[model samples]
Target: MVASVEEVSSSLVREYLSRKGLKRTIACMDEEHPRTEASINNRSQLRETLHIEDLYRKNKVDKSPFKTLLEIIVKHHIEQFVSLEPNDTKADEITSAVVCGKQSKIRPETEEECPSQPSYRSLMCEQDGLSSHDHIASANDSDCQKSQPLIPFLENNVSFGQRKPDINTMKPEDTQRSRSNRIRRGMMAGPVPQESTKKRQSRRAEVSQPLLSKEEENKQAQERLLFTGIHKKNLERSLTGISIADCGGGKPSGRVQSENSNGKVEQNMQKTRNVKTEPNLSDLNVSELVLDDIDDDDLREFSKVSLQRTVAKCQYTGRPMDKQTATELKAVLLGSSLNYFSVEWRNQSFTFSEIPELSYGIVQRKGGPCGVLASIQAFVLKKLLFENTEISYTGLQRLRPSNATRRQCLVLAMAEILWRAGEEKQATVAIKSGKSHFTPSDHFRSEEVLEKIMCFTVDNLKDLQFILEQHIEQFDSGMLGCILLTISAVLSRSVEKVREDMDVPSTTLIGAHGYCTQELVNLLLCGRAASNVFDNDMELDSGNGNMMLLKGIKSHCDVGLLSLFEHYNICKVGAYLKTPSYPIWVVCSESHFSVLFGLQRELLTNEDKGLEFDLYYYDGLANQQEEIRLTISIGNLSQSFQEVDTDLIPPLELCIRTRWKDAFVSWNDTEPLL
Candidate 1:
């Protein structure tokens, strides 16, 4: 008969405790066979002992102190027994008995049986105080019939020691056989001898139970018609569908057999039944049906590939549309496709134009100008206007220049016509004639005229400055005065005031005034203007206007100009005189005297000459002192002053003193020289 479940449970616990090296304290009630030294004899007895020990250790034993010990035993078992070779005889037998209920063979009776039991007379002879073994032997003799079930008793309670069967008195051959059986059982049990057959059976039973119900099966089948995920869901869906036999075996009528499809035959049948009642199948959107099936990566790849293919197709057809043309086509297609299918492509279409506009109506929706097209139009406009081509006013009006793009083209054409006229040396003739070919008034201004003017002013400043500087020598003092005065006038005006009247940076007006003034200066200094002052044809106003010009020059003088004079002091004479015929030597000497006298007067009067002067003087003196200390820095300065003659320096000094004395005499006679 099989052992009771309680006995098996206890046996398993004892086995576990033994493996964990836990002490077994349960006293067996049937001490009739005095407890011998515990040793396992048979494979069943060995397994039963191990199982009971294991259960005892797991439940009754405290784990806090022996947690690390339990982990070591668990790891050993996993390594030794869990990973045991399938072909290993002992492992195979143990696994089969646990997993499949196959029992190992018992040892033969003759080799296993004890010889004549140890006699009570012998125990008495030995006088060993009637040891537990003797006590068990005496009980066995008296209750031999009842004690025949000792195997059951051992299986129920014995745990964690070698089995003793009156070993000192057992026959030699029986002992040898018993020992061999014990060894075989130990090898078969492997490392985790407490891993019981019943527990393994229960675990396998729990794992094998079906997870889905009839309704769940049907729902899963419907889902399969839609999509299939990996592993768990795929297996569930596969099991839910119908078999070919259930579908009457004519190739399963509703099934779409794709090799890539993971949905099983059973799931497809369930899907077919659910879908049968749904109407308007043709109108059903494929995306709506299978969106869940698509992975994010797959969707991205699809979009990229579709766009690339579309671009390639457009290119290959030779009627290749530009981006604007493509956008227009896509918009038209989207509108038509939406109306035809009663489905909006606003969400479906990829192109920018196909996207919905703000709810502001179609009239408000117009495409903006492209940058490159605007540039090209501007270039074309410049060419048409200035190239001396015969263009009618009617033709110009019909050009339909509504946007910045068309306006730019017209401007460019006008510029080009003017440029060509100049390049051909016909600019003067064209300007004088008034009716000379190309006319481009339409290209004159933009909507943002003030902005354009500001940009123009900023763009041309460097060039304007360069031109002024280059011809600066040609300008007479009168013209230079006018230029400086004009600049000063503009600078003196508040920028806000200028903006109120001019609608541009004050810099623009300042620049234009400077340019015109500089040009006038250039003409006056070069003596290029007509000489007769009152003559209608002459442009010069030589009387009081010239005196006004001198006053403007004096007013314009500032620290900056003075520093320039000091930096290129000799160059100042070269700039003012312009020609050798003018008494440059006399003027330069006088100017140098005036500068020195002015400095001395400022020092005497305790007035500020300016920070520029102070910095120049301080830096120069400091540098001289450093040179005196080091000498190397003054190497190049020796050659720079070579033009100054040592003999002429005395006469220069006398002349400076005379000028200062004359100035002082004139001043002292008038109002006490204050």
Candidate 2:
């Protein structure tokens, strides 16, 4: 290996990160490279890891063959190394490194997975999923130079020049018997590329290079076909337990299989299937699709695997936040966060700010972090809705207490948004020892709990739950102060009381749901929990008598849900929820909550018949996946490529329409995503 292995490996990892669209990770690596924990030390290992050895040789970059194995070790983490048995011979120690970024451990396979011929072939077959029969049949094919009884247990000590002659006369049985000793010859070296009298041995050897290229291309094409889209992503997780890093194992660096190996393939498949593993991240399109089934262990694995390779930044400072320093976020930080992202349309593109602080605090999906999610939406919207610069990252970082960290700043933001979202927006409101009083929010109905901001004080973190139980009896069980970063709420009420007030049957309230619903959202916004999405107040039977439901939001709101307006089709909804004071609205499609915001504020006021305004999508459940920035152009001109409205509308488009009615969204060059 060259002395500059770290430099070279760093460059290769950078390229890999970029190719995977990991922009933030790339930035992180640049800021902290030579400081990286692990790296591949040579060309052969690099080629094998990337499966681009042919691509490297194709462009005549480095024609070096594999002569040494990778020794990628993390700094100060030497205990992670697992060496093979000392007596097993040098071939048994030829280990491969996993390049998922943080920790690259050498996978210890069974003794049969050594680098000697047969076992090496099996290992390659395991990786590239190639079969052995292809090699067996090719033994007597025209590609072979000669045929004769071959020697069994042929030692690798054969002279380099005599090796070709010695192997040409080798028999299949002899090859198998000598598999353990044939280490120098290697697996799938393809008989050193033979030639007949139609070409001399040198010409044949030269011809083999082109054949290697063709074979590599065919393998790559097949691999691409085998692992496209979600299949490819799933393979990354299952093969290496890497969530964000590219496993680069989609196309194993080997050839295709044949009929005889079908049984071996099935045997391997059975072994793989028998390995008890967790279910994979599903391809479901529902909003809560990933979280409903996601586990805490998954979250832990997700964090460990991600932080191993990726070093995210402090969202406020843009300084490197390595995995160790990042762990603090989970223990101390609390609050909702804004996921500002950008989009493109009509060749025009825009990007919003990033909340890279999602290190240990990635969305806690099972609890439906809607309070955190919605509060952040309100925070970001308020930041843009008002002239206050305090909402900005740097501005928030410089918040009161002077020494407050980035996490505490988010908690402060959540509290501020609740206050701002209240009717009697006060400088301070705190519930004290066993005392509870309600001051109405401007929008809180006089009929229900007139109070907003069910403030409670907690001297000890352990006592937060007890304090909430004693004071705010209606506090959402799943989303408590521990998760939302505060012991206060904009409003809180029991579902039974809400249902009774809305004339809903008690039969529907039997079970505890793990997701947020319309009534809960309305309760969060207004003190009264209304069930119906109406333009104005509707008279309803409260079982006591006819009662007036407060007409939906009167004055412009800080943040709004567009699904209610879209589903009800009320013209008056446009003034309140459809268009908040700012250009952001929470979109609920397929029972998930994403936000749609635009770069320009005119998007809300523009009343043109076919008004065109750009919008962006931030998946409610994802803090890691890339958000979409849509450049919308709505006009009478329709292109032939545009599909009719009757076609299956992608869920993304439906979410967008919940915010903008009669929107004719064109994907431009992008295929419509379902």
TM-score for all predictions?
Answer: 0.13, 0.37
What Cα-based lDDT does every candidate model obtain? 0.27, 0.40
Rate residue 250 of model 1 by lDDT.
42
User: Tens digits of per-residue lDDT for model 1 on 1-674?
Assistant: 55455554443444344344342132131112111123221224644543535633553355552333334356556667877777666775575344423354443445333333423333331332333343344334344323332333333333445454665678989767755654444321123255465455334323422566656545545564455422223222233332223335344533342333443223232222222222222222223333323445547744654444343333211122123322222222122111111111111110011101100001101111111112122233233323324333232221212122222333332222222312222111000111212221332221121111111011122322332232222221111212222221222222233233221222222112111221112112222111111112213356786621211111111111121232233322222221112111121122221111111112222322221111001011011121011111111223434455635333333222221221111121212100
- Writing each residue's lDDT as its tens digit, candidate 2 over 1-674 gives 34355555675665455345465575466445532223442345556655655444534533543222221222112333344455553323343222211122243443233223333333443343222333333332332222222223232333344443344477978766555333323445344333344234223223323334555545543443443433534644543544433334343322332214212210000001223454343332222213212345546755654443322211111122122221222111111011111111011111122232121122434334443455454444444334344333332221111111223333333444444333333222223222223332333222211122233332333233333323331322222332222223322232233444343432221112334445545544443345544444656566767675543444456566666335445423445666666776667655566666665667777767678766655553554443355766545345543455634767666556555556677666555556
Q: Cα deviation in Å at residue 635, candidate 1? A: 22
Task: Compare the candidates by lDDT and give the number of the best one.
Answer: 2
Q: Poorest 10 consecutive residues of model 1 by lDDT?
A: 355-364
Pick by TM-score: which candidate is best? 2
lDDT score for candidate 2 against the true structure: 0.40
